[model samples]
Target: MSGRIVVGVDGSEPALKALKWAAAQAALTGDSLEVVTSWEYPASWSTMMPGVPTEFDPEQLAKEILNASLEKALDPATAAAARRTVVGGNPAQALVDTAKGATLLVVGDRGYSGFKAAVLGSVSTNVTQHAPCPVVVVRGESAAS
Candidate 1:
C-alpha cells in the first residue's frame, strides 16, 4: 500500500512549519498528505449556565480553522497534490486516532501556547508517546537553529 502522511495544523507558526515539511516529504515519497486540525470549546465557555445551549460547535470551528490554516500552509501547487481533513476533539486524541492508519504523523514542536516555557505542546508530546505510527515533531525555526 502507498504511504500516507498526516500532519496536525492549527494555524500557528510551528504548525505552518510542520505543514511545509510534510508537504515536501509527501511530494518526495509519493505519499498522500492529510492535513488535520482539531478544535474544542473551552469548559468555561460551555459552562455559561444550565439551559443555555453552547454557542460554540467544535466541529464547525474545526472546519473553519482547518480551512484557514490549510490556505496559509499550502500553496496552490502543493495543495493540489494533497488531501485535507479536519476533526473535532482534543488535539492529542485526534492526532493519535488519525495516526492509526498513517505511515507517519507530523506535528509542530509547539502550538498555540499561553506560556513560553511550554515545550512541544501537549498534543505533540502525547502523539510522540502514543501514536500508532512514526511521529515527527518539527521544532520552531529558532529551535532548529
Candidate 2:
C-alpha cells in the first residue's frame, strides 16, 4: 500500500498467475510493481557429466524467463511499466532480499504435495516466513491459457 509490490516469477504456470495478480494489485493500490527472477548454479555443476554443455548461462536464462513471463502475464503497457530484476542466489532468499522495502511480496503456490513440500521446502512458504513485508501466495492457473 505504502510501498512497492514485489513479485517472484520462475516461468511456471502458477508463477505467471502470481505475476498477473500482483500487477492487478499494484494497479488498484497505485503502487509500483517489481518483478523478480533468480538463478543459481547447481551443486553438482562442478562434477557434471562430460557431455553436458558448458555454454549454459543461468543469468541469461533467468532474464529470458523474466521477460517472457512479464509479456505473458500482463498487457504490453503494464509489462513495460513493471520493473524487472534478475538475481543470483536461492529463489526464496533473492525474493526476500529484493522485497526488503516493499509493501507486499507476492509468489505462486508451486503445487508441491504436502509430503513433497515438507521434504523439498516451498519458496512461497519460506518467503512468507522470512520476507520483511506482507506476503501473498497466489494459487491459480495461468491466464495465458
Candidate 3:
C-alpha cells in the first residue's frame, strides 16, 4: 500500500527532526509526505470577559503556521514528495484524525515543553496510542544529525 505519510509539525526542534525523518522515509518508499500542523486560539484570549471582541482566528493561524512549517520542512530537490495540511484543533486530535487515511504518522517526541518528562509529550504519546496507522516518534539529536 503506497499511501502518503503524515507528519505533525510545529516550530519546535523535535518537530523539525520528525519532518526531516518523514521526508527521508517518503523518498525511500516513494510515498508522499503530508506535513500537518494544528493551531487554536488560546482560551484566555478568546474569552476576555465574556466575548469582548476576540481578534483570534484559529483556522487562519493554523494555515499560516502549517505553510511556514512545510516550507521549512520541504527541500526544493524533493518537492515532489511533500504536501502540507493545516487542521485547527487539539494537536493530538488533529494528528490522530489525519492518521486514519495515512500509511504512517510521524511526530516529535517532545514539543515546546515547559517541564521535563522522561517520556514523550502528551500529544505524541496520545497519537502513538490512538493513531489508526503506524506511528513513529522521532527524538534525540542523532535523528536530526
Q: Which pairs of residues collide in model 2?
A: none
Task: Give per-model CA RMSD.
Answer: 3.1, 3.9, 3.6
Where model 1 places Cα greater than 4 Å from the true spot, the runs are 46-56, 143-145
Predictions in order: lDDT: 0.84, 0.87, 0.81
Is candidate 2 or 3 superior in TM-score?
Answer: 2
| The candidate that achieves the highest TM-score relative to the unseen native structure | 2
Give the per-residue lDDT digits (tens) of candidate 2, residues 1-145: 2569999999887789999999999999999999999999878885864566789788998999999999988999999999999999999999999999899999987733344324223788899889999999887543353
Candidate structures ordered by lDDT, highest first: 2, 1, 3
Ranking by TM-score: 2, 1, 3
lDDT of 3 by residue, 9-112 (tens): 88788898888899899878887888888886567764554664566566776777666666676677664446777887899999999888889999998888
**Ranking 2 against 3 by lDDT, winner:** 2
**Residue 54 accuracy (lDDT) in model 1:** 55
What lDDT is obtained when candidate 2 is compared to the true structure? Answer: 0.87
